[model samples]
Target chain A: MIRICIFMMILLATYSCNDVLDVPSQSDEDIVLELWNHIDRNYCFFELKGINWDSIKTASLARLNVSTSESDLFEICGDMVLALEDGHAFLRNGQTNIVYDFKEGYDVHFDPIIVEKKYLNSSFQREGIYTYGMINDSIGYVYLYGFQNRELFENIKGYFKQRNPQKLIIDVRNNGGGDSALSLEIVEYLIDEETKVGYISVKNGEERDDFTEVANVVATLSSNNYPVKTNILINRGSYSASSYLAGMVKYIDNINVIGQITGGGGGGGQSFELPNGWVVRIPHHYFLDAKMNHIELGVEPDVEIENTELDIMNQRDLMLEMAIEY
Target chain B: MIKFDLDTYRLRFSLTPIKHGVTGLMLMISASVFSQSNKTMFFKAGFVQQSTFENRLTSNYRGGVGLNLELGFEKTSEKYVSRFSLDYSKANQGKSYISYSTIYKVDLKYENLKRIHTIKGLYIGGYIDVGTMINEKNGLWGSTNNPISFTQWASLGMVAQYSVKFKNDYLWNMSLSTPIVSYIIRPSYGSVWPDKFLEPQNFNLYERGIVTAGLKSGNVALFNNFSNTIIKTSMYFPFKNSQWHYGLEYSFNRIHTNEIKPLKQFANTISISFKRL
Candidate 1:
């Protein structure tokens, strides 16, 4: 027994993990090929968007050589990521992020200078990324630039107690988006029961059409309720979780979404490491709005209020003005 | 908040001696602590090492090593023996020891063996073990609500054991176990925000649901697979009325999955246990 015990102890004491695996190659071909292959199998959209990923991959490889510079390769990879037309598509390169933008033709209407000087002046109180104040005395206004707000609902509650406004305006014009859960927390407060918001699913297999079973997206009852009618203002820059918020709350009666068509980024994305160490973020989960309409590109406003260049030049945000007027 | 920086995301201790000395000190302390103590609680400290290839995250395999701690017990009788264990481990994985990514895991297990026959000092029996392994990686962030990469599994496996006795006073036990069938839960492909986060109340065909897996998973074009095997042996030394138990355990897990990544992991640990009369 003593001999067996000693042997096992000796074995355990001597055991050590060796660094055995060969280092991965960082050649240009290897980098591009890895990105192409990984995206080919893992990227969720192709069939949905009718994109020829193979053709893009072929073209991208042709542009590269064994001696392609890091900057040129980055641009090439960036171009490939943009081919999906997904605004959520982002290639993280160090501190400078290579992100996709679909808001080129669509103009940004929210004039921060005008809103600050004209509407908020010195009355706005800030919480997280949301900036808020009363615009028409009886009407409350909240400008949400991002959903990184943890105290969003709390900020609004304070505003309610202080102003006692009958209606609230939620301006999400250039709000790029953040945690969707934060958006849901506020939306759930406006509804009564557990509501079916939409259907959500994602790509499941290597095939472009391969998808997981669809799940009915439901919003449960909120523990606390917000007082007053709500109006959400959006524009071409409203995307991802912002669009998701609009799509979700469109089912509520008391809440109104008023603005131009939003920048549609209606799926969830995940990140992967490129052979060159750049991080690529892509979305696979796509959502179907309450009426089963695809909101992947953007969400249509319940009431379209186009904020023209003329409006901005005249120091007026028509979208915000419309919400305040309503 | 989780930050996925391209360069590195590692939490290193400020004190070098503490960080470097922890492994050896923990091994010695845990060995002595457990030995002085069957139907008994025990503690174990060891190294957990892994080589992982999750095509969803990267094309190349990543290697890592870190500390592992386990708390478990063994109860034995002439006709039967029962064992239970729970363990936690954390590791940072990347090439050349670069702490680019982190993985956290928790494991739970239970086993019961009934002796069918005994020849010489060798007793043979089949044991039943039901357990689960939950592993989460938080090294890189890809997208908001990427509900897809979550991986956890509840499995049932078959066990085989060998018992040895010397001079009718000392006891030695060895066992091998494999997870043959499992009801695995993972986020459906491409979904952001794992089901565990989004639909905690619902576990259906879609969202957070059970996907059946057998000996092997996945197919030709691109795939990651899992095969879980565990080997354990323990020796008991009696002192007066109380008993001391020394043990060695090694697990070879070929993390077969269709979730996000496929990992090859090996855990080596030694433990001492104390039991009452």
Candidate 2:
């Protein structure tokens, strides 16, 4: 019996020692299929956007042949991914870049030159990643164009604590989101109590609805005391974490969001690389408001005001003016 | 009392030599006379090297070097033996990721001391082990920002061991174990960032407890989704007939799984141990 056991152990050991280096051979079609399957399994917005992924795959496969160039394959893959209509989705190779088309026919509503000359009288104070000053020496105006830096919020908070302005305006027009944590940190300075902001869930399986249980996301008050009343300026360009911030601010007190509806991007982006060294990014997590409503469509402002071409031509930010009036 | 109890004294003296000779014969028949029933404690520390590949994160398998430490205790009797050990290891895979793991294992076995006709001091045993492994991997590439994959598994396996002792008090041991079942905790297809997952209300005991999500309902699998194989060998030499013994040990462990990602890991370690009987 002992000899039999020893012999079996040796046999098992010999079988296990076989190295399992099973790297899949990637042909052009194989790479396309890999990309499709990755997105099919991981992308968060498939069902929400009513995408027919199988049809898309079939169409894409029909475009690929033995003689298709890599550039052409990249384009076909890019076009197939763009069908998801998510701004966070993109495909990039060495020389080509494909991104969701966010530009619409709306005229540019924000011009810094005009705002600086007409609104702040050329006295806009520039801090780290933030430009701040008083509009009419009353309303504190802080313009944050991006959410990349966490320290910028601290500087803005310190500047506001000293001034003790009764009203403040946070302009996030054209602010493309960077890091959601930084956006949440900025939200911390705007509230004084535990605020149930929203819920977040991630794709748990390959099925479209295979999501984990919704996890409640909350914002706690910061150490610094900010202004009692706040106005957030947003436009169609506010996206991703910027849209997430807009959703959170609606739950806070004494804060009025005023502007055009934000350009919605409520999904968190995750990146995967294709076999040919190109990279593809897709949204893999969903962010919803406290009411369980998906925020993929841009969040509506408390007071929806559209800036006209006339307003820009006159060097007047109508939204900022509305925030000051509020 | 002056009338000596001659029968009792004569019987005691006569039985003493007979008892001594019987004990000598028994000792001669025993294969390993030095392996008396005793409890022992051991401490081991060593260098570890690991190679890992996860298809969800990257295509290339990466290698890392790190350290491992273990503490163990074993009890031996004529009928059975039992041992318990705790091991911790940490390794870094280039700039992409780092992994840390801890395992606590208990093994119970029945010893078979019957020797082959020509070979001496040979002992064979079959053991069943129950253990838990907690592993965490943190790095970039999986998500937008920093990503972390945390997994915990309750494991059970069977092992077969062969041990031999030489007349010079040197002992050699070899064992192989394969997992029978494991309850594994793997993140869903898309994992939330750690900062969000650690939120007060978002974090719950269920996420860290046995009732958490897994590959199947009730989260138990019999070598279907997750499998592990381990092999170890050691040699021990006593120091001048003292209770203390020093030994060198080498181990190889591999785990393969098909979950959110197809992940395969191989770890090799060599260590020196000190055991006290």
Candidate 3:
């Protein structure tokens, strides 16, 4: 009986049934493939390009093999994307919003005219590239680039009051843009009090005095009447805020703008971040002159002063020379 | 003293020698005879080394314990033959390895030759077996706390064996048998990944549900499935007595499925047993 029991137990142990299920692991090749799949599925404009996905696969493998770390792989991906040749499709880290100019010269092109005045507590630095003759023997030739800086404008005004210059040359060349609020204030000292500056029509898709900001400047200028002769110079780079200065002066009977057609562009743009962690800057609002036209194409200069290679070789600035002659 | 009952005379005596000596002697004599019986009870234990190459850069090795139990019963009247067997093994290497398996076999056989209740001769028989496979591994991702584990679909197979019994006596018995053919369902083996993220092409098929589905569909294609099974023709040689028996078997197995490269090998197994007949 005991023997039979042992045998039965062994038989039972041997005959029992069991079942097991399992899941599998993924390989490195699969990871690379998945990355590409995600890009193809989500990237904008994927269908438009004649991209060889198979070659991309081989290239990605070769790239990954050489990557020493995760960041290296990311950089390789960036390089591959850049190879796609779409200027707008570039990749960059989503950090700092600041854009830098690595070129040798200053972003704005101009020289400074420093003058001392008694009414003003500080000295004045008037920036411009055109030269107008000296007012007093002490106050030398002067060229005004921008009127935006309040302290700088006040001191310069004090100097003008003291010296009473014969002519003022304002150069807007290389003046990309800045605040237009100070233009009217500077114009008050330069023009007759009642003179009307040209009107501005800010085509910002709204209806209100289009040039409300410039009107504010004109209002201040109309209140303060100081008579002075001024000359403004314009160029290809004279745009936006700088054009506003040139336009305000040229509207008056005495002030004159001398140069070629401005690149009429007065649109306000906004920067935004894209889904792929890239930053894009696009024009959000448009600007117009008193004539209700876009400033983006630029405010055309009243007097066309075309500079040529011979002019540069002769070390002659025809625009400034013309302004002086006018 | 003797008591007479009917036409028979009965003699009763206290023959319990040494208080238990005669029973012990009888037991000793019977044990020897039983050890040589045609019907045998078998016990075997060994280590099985299983190697699988994925055809990738790496190959896996698993070493585990294997045990077998075989019971062969043959009665003279009709050469009534039957075999019951149990086999278990488990092996692993590194982070991956095969899981434990428990196999049970029960075979009922009929012999061609017949004799009185005490004797039997040649017989041909077939058997059916049901088996199960379990796989255990660590979870792809998550706390090491939650290890991954699962079981495979139950497997079933049929096998045929041919045997011949020579002599039956107080001293010993002798026999020989061979297993002809077998048909079986094999379990698929694989690993677990954190996500579908990095799996090889068709790797997901090794997963539990897919593997089961594939088996149901008669076998998955090479790209999608992997498994293990031994199909072979074998020869068995046995020497037995009334109380004990010894046997040896040699088989040429061809592994045509469940591998990157099909393999063929000749393997042998030896068994020892004791029985009562």
Candidate whose TM-score is highest: 1
Per-residue lDDT of A158 in model 3: 55
Q: Could you tell me the TM-score of candidate 3?
A: 0.32
Cα error, candidate 1, residue B49 (Å):
1.8
Query: Which lDDT values do the candidates have, in the order given?
Result: 0.63, 0.66, 0.37
Instruction: List per-model TM-scores for chain B.
Output: 0.62, 0.66, 0.39
State the lDDT of candidate 3 residue by residue for B16-124, as single tens digits. 3322543454354445433434554443333334332221111122223233333334433244555554443333422322121221122233323322232233233
The interface root-mean-square deviation of each model, in the order shown, is: 9.7, 21.2, 37.9
**Docking band of candidate 1:** incorrect
Poorest lDDT segment (10 consecutive residues) of candidate 3 chain A: A16-25
TM-score of 1: 0.76
Winner by TM-score between candidate 3 and candidate 1 = 1
Ranking by lDDT: 2, 1, 3
What DockQ results for candidate 1?
Answer: 0.18
Error of 2 at A287 (Å): 1.9
lDDT of 3 by residue, A1-326 (tens): 43353343333223221111111223334444544543333232222345555577688778666334645554655554544333223333343222212111312222222212311124334344222335334322444443344456555555556666677666667565544444545565666653444442211211221111222123233343446556777776665556666665655677778876543334332222222223322222233343544454457677877666565555556666677677
Per-candidate interface DockQ score: 0.18, 0.10, 0.01
- What digit string (tens of lDDT, one per residue) describes model 1 on residues B118-167? 34333333333333332334444544344224345655655557766787
